[model samples]
Structures are given as C-alpha cells and as structure tokens.
Target: MHSHTNLIAVLLLTVLIHEGSAIWCYRCTSATPGCGETFNWRGIGYLGEHCPEPDDICVKLTERRGGSETITRDCLSALNFRKDIPADKYEGCRPAAKDERLAHYVNHTIKEHDVRRDYFTDTTFCFCFLDHRCNGASGMQVSAVMALLTVAAALLLR
Candidate 1:
C-alpha cells in the first residue's frame, strides 16, 4: 500500500544519508624502515579505518635513536595534539606546555649496536587532516536529520 511505499522510501533515504556521511582515515605503525607512502597504501602495513568521533585527527609520530628511527600513525584525540615542536625531544607526543613531561601517546626505545647500547630519544609528533579530506560533519548530519523530518511529514500527510 502507500504506507509500505513510504517506509521503503524512508529506509532508502536513511541508507544514503549514512553512506554519504561516513568518514575514513589511514591507520598504521612502522619502525626502522618506516611506512612507505603511508597515504597511498590500503592494506597490510597501512589500513583505511573509520574516524568514529568528532575530534579525531590523523597523527604521525617519529622517534630517532642514534642511527635508527621509528614511526607510528593513527587517529587520535585532538585535545592531546600539541602546538610546540621541541628540540631533542624524547617522547612521541607531549603537551603544549613546556613544564609538562607526560607523553600523550606512544614511547619506545632503540639499540645503537646489538643490545649493548640501548638509548631512548625524543619523538616528533605531527597532526594532519584525515586523508586531507574530512573537515568534520560539513552539515551532512543536519541534512540527514532534515530528510528524516521531511519523510515523517510526508507519512503524516498520507
């Protein structure tokens, strides 16, 4: 009947709304050799994952120890993203305030030669837009909600 048709239309609209609003970002971790062309790859070492929350931002962390280096990439909270870049940094992610020594994220060590001369060094943290794409909601959610309201009105009219 007409009610069944309206239900189908609403469901289809809901699916379209969800699909258009979905946001995804790259996720990965690498050490020594580093993750090659992280933005380009899609499998194994690099993965495309959903950015679930509103404040999620893509993060890249690099650590250097004598000759070796380590890198990690993932979606992280923007509240912890710092502005000040330090010289001779020893932790992956740190607070913007210089007095704070707590690292917001990952921290690890490296050995200069075999396991004899192990040393931990400072890390550099960088935040970038997810795939240089998503800039948050972009009013898509609002539009979807409006669409649902329209569908409800149409049903009521019938």
Candidate 2:
C-alpha cells in the first residue's frame, strides 16, 4: 500500500524531471546564448527569425593591436543583426578577425612565386566554437538512468 504510493511518487518525479529537461532544452535551443547552432532535436537547427542572406562585404574593423584594415569577406550581412543570435555571433566557418600577418605572408609568398612553399607557409587556420550550456544527450541519459533506477527499486520491493 505504502509501496504503491512510493512507486507513484517516483513515477511522478521522473515525469517532472523529464518535463523540466524538455523546457530547459527549448530555452537553450531558442535562447540567444545557444544560438541554436548545435545539438538540435527533430532536425530543427534554429528557430524564430531566419538568418539574413549572407553577403560579401568590405569588413572595416580595428584589430586587437588597434590596426585598422579593410577585407572583403562573405558574412551574414544584416545591418540589423538577428535578435536571437548571440551578440558576438560566430559561426565556425567565419573568420572573426582579420589576420594581417597571414595576409602579409600570403602576399610575400605569392610575390616570390614559390607555389608549394607559399601555400604551406602562408596558410593559417583559426577555430571558432559554439557555446553549449547543457549536454542534451547526457542530460537525457541521466534522466533515463534515474527513471530506470526508480523502476528497479520499485520492482525489488514487490
């Protein structure tokens, strides 16, 4: 009798945990911090406003060293950035900074006409990362484990 109540309580707690997780997932996916860039469910990557068509624009900005330069790059060129995207929205493929050193190296190598050496020496790579607040997969696994443990305990009592 009391054990039945305990089973019901565990089941209710499991449902609550699942619901909370679902809500958290929704918030994280649609939230500005997450940018909806990764870890999507049901094949939906991002929600809300569609990112404006990208354009190749002359990006004029000052580097960390305070050197100003202009470079032509294709970016999601919306004059008014989307509200849902993070303030410093960085897609992995996009170049966040104008690496002047790299540009100089490329030009120098090109002038020398050393194709193989130039290609290898002048090539520079930078990494961009997406933010993840909650481990969606891990969270689901933990939730499953909790539910399974609850079930196992309930069955053992019977």
The best candidate in terms of lDDT:
1
- What local lDDT score does residue 51 receive in model 2, on the 0 to 100 scale? 22
lDDT of 2 by residue, 37-143 (tens): 34344444443232233221111111122342222111234323322222443332232323334334454434557332222222211112121112232334655
Clashing pairs in 1: 89-122, 90-122
Compared with the true structure, all predictions reach lDDT values of 0.49, 0.34
- Model 2 residue 39 CA deviation (Å) reads 9.6
Indicate the worst ten consecutive residues by lDDT in candidate 1.
Answer: 130-139
Model 1: residues with Cα > 4 Å off, grouped in runs: 1-23, 31-47, 78-119, 130-158
**RMSD over all Cα atoms, model 1:** 11.4
TM-score of each: 0.40, 0.26
**Which residue pairs overlap in candidate 2's backbone?**
none
**Candidate 2 worst ten-residue window by lDDT:** 124-133
